[model samples]
Target: MTNRLVTLFKFGIVGVANTTVDAVMFALLAVIGVPLLIAQVISYSCGVANSYWLNGRWTFRDAAREGNERAKLIRFLITNLVVLVLSAQILMSLHNMLGWSLVMSKTLTTLMGMVLNYMASRYWVFRLAIK
Candidate 1:
């Protein structure tokens, strides 16, 4: 329990870094005339790639195992794919349907995605292997 909390804290820190990558890249592409959806796809992919290494090394160090980094990265990417789809829907709803600013919608979706990622990472992606 306590360990989970500590891990969550570390996860949050890593998430901020990842989110910054996503957001900054999104902003860059947006300024260059790329559509938001396409920008998001590219930005989020970059972030997820960064996330696997950071979370595996830091947030769930003990949960990582030998001989399975490739498998773990695949699982991590799958989890992020689900989360990204969900996030895109939410972003579309808030920013496009509801007329919120893109930044605001992205912020809201980022929070939601962060929670989902933590849950998935803890339970599925980074779970300690049983004997």
Candidate 2:
């Protein structure tokens, strides 16, 4: 339990850093006149790679899976895609049904997605090493 909590703490720290990276990239792309959707895709991809590196090195180091590096990266990307879908649903529910402000909805979405991301990273992307 304590270890899990510690992992969560590390994950949160990495998340904050990755979120900042995403926002900065998105803002830079937008300011340079990239279309909003294009900017979002580019920024989100940046965050995905950042998440994998930080989480692998710091957040779930003990759980890092033993496998081909390419396979691990592929799994990480797929997990993030699922996380994005779930977060989109949460955001719609919070913003549309619950009448939350856009910022509030997004904040909630990010928090919820973090849980999924951690679980997937631990059990799937970074599963305990084979003996």
lDDT of 2 by residue, 1-131 (tens): 88778877998899998999999999999999999999999999898889999988778766564567787788999999999999999999999999999999998898889989988887888876612
**Each prediction's whole-model lDDT (CA):** 0.87, 0.87
User: Largest TM-score belongs to which candidate?
Assistant: 2
Collision count for each candidate, in order: 0, 0
TM-score of 2: 0.89
What does candidate 1's lDDT look like per residue over 8-79, in tens digits? 899999998898998899999999999999998899888887799889888888778643778788889899
Query: Where does candidate 1 stray beyond 4 Å?
Result: 23-42, 98-103, 129-131
Could you tell me how far off, in angstroms, the CA of residue 82 lies in candidate 1 after the best superposition?
0.7
Which pairs of residues have clashing backbones in candidate 2?
none
